[model samples]
Target: MQYAQKPELYATGTIQLWEDPHIAKGMLEAHLAPDNDAASRNHQFIDRSVKWLSTLSPVEAAPKVIDFGCGPGMYTSRLAKLGYEVTGVDISENSINYAKEDAVSNNLHINYRNESYLELKDEGLYDWAILIYCDYSVLSPEQRQTLLENIKRALKPGGKLIFDVFTPYQYEPLKESHSWYAENASGFYKDGPHLCLFSHFLYEDDVYLDQYVIIDEMDQVDVIRVWDRSFTVARLQQEIESAGLKLSAYYSNVAGDLYNEASKSLCFVVEKW
Candidate 1:
């Protein structure tokens, strides 16, 4: 007897990282990993980011800031401690709860919202808006444009929007492949006896897809898809300008380091006025 072949198609997103209980639990675990050396995932990077933001001309005076995709209050709490009025927004309820708890424990006054950044409004209120962790790169081109417009609308005149995006150097060398793993009551997929298949695919438009297919003990199958869009300086400059924002500076990794030709990711600073 032969088992039926597994279906191969566009990965259906069911095991959501930001929503499902198991996935959310896994995400929170990743966010709180007790290591600072991991850039973008720990406190050392947060400190570095806050220090770099402080060096920016607009942030030198501690202007009100909006931290979009502000997971676990990493950057938001620090910015608030640095004396900038802060509002943090994220989609994960768990993360937002944790962020609020952190804010209260630190005696930091910060407005934390559990919502989508695409729904952001409150025009002309923020002096600075930031979307870190390469969150902007995961959005579609249209969504990117909308996000920029929303950020622009939310900014005060001359206010700036800062974000980061991975360039070709990060994606060009990534080869598409598939793999399998066993999850026995641990890992991103909990419960017992899960056969997980992982896939990576690249598109012509610099979009990359990372998908997971998991079949659990009771024969329940789940899918999750993550998209990453890569960019070049010229292409990014055009996109920023098209969104009605003025590109002011581009740096390597948000540390205010110069963006050289070989940079894997570049951080952008754009002004609304």
Candidate 2:
């Protein structure tokens, strides 16, 4: 009997580190790994948010919660266990697939949707919305405002929306130019074990750029680029107000401390009118 041919596995999209689905999936999976330090930090942040949610009186019905950019459903599973009806929305199909599989393995029920935040509108369907892990900063200023407006519409009256963004201080230590070079037999591999030469630069305008060249043992090579933007507290606050949401609180740390200039993250709780 003849066997069917298997499909080739290769990076898709712009080949940039941030846009390449394969690399993005790998990075997200690593961060969501249970034993990873980043995962531990994320859990602590979620715990603190859950604690705050606990203080609110139980609604007549369980509040519907949406996790924006919920990569692999790490926090989605936790929120489901807390008795909240959880829905995780992600732009990445690969991420959503992995999240669904992970949720099934854990015997947890979560609604995982492959959709962008821009597509989520206030259908009066959710009581709480979350854009955790500094996901809000992932969008441009215009896109951010659009997302907030959609979240506002999705919430019921007095519903809550919470999100985090990196502060201006996050760019303080990053230099304008940095580079690295390495070589090895495995270095020529583009998608496998390889030596990588990398360079990164942080601009004064709150944008960061990185470029990487991977070389495998066979001398094969590929290049990847990445860019990220940071937001200021004032700008974020203005956007929140423009969305018709009231900023209930701002925390500098996951532990609910007041925001300060030195804080790397700006966590906000906003209530929809």
Prediction RMSDs, each to the true structure:
3.1, 8.0
Across residues 123-160, which tens digit of lDDT does each residue of candidate 1 receive? 88888888887899877777887888888898899998
What lDDT tens digits, residue by residue, belong to model 2 across residues 1-273?
011111122212136443455566566766576556442255555676666654542334545888888877766877777777889998777778888998899888899998888887548898888777776665656777788888888888888887777787877777655455565332322445576666565554586655566666677666665455677777778878887889888888545678887888888888998
Clashes per candidate, residues 3 or more apart or on different chains: 0, 11
Q: Candidate 2, which ten residues in sequence have the lowest lDDT sum?
A: 1-10
Model 2, C-alpha of 235: deviation from truth (Å): 2.4
**Candidate 1: C-alpha lDDT:** 0.80
lDDT of each: 0.80, 0.69
Which portions of model 1 show Cα errors greater than 4 Å? 1-12, 34-39, 57-62
Q: What is the lDDT of residue 35 in candidate 2?
A: 51
Give the winner by TM-score: 1
What TM value does model 2 have?
0.78
Model 1 — which ten-residue stretch has the worst lDDT? 1-10
Report the number of the highest-lDDT candidate: 1
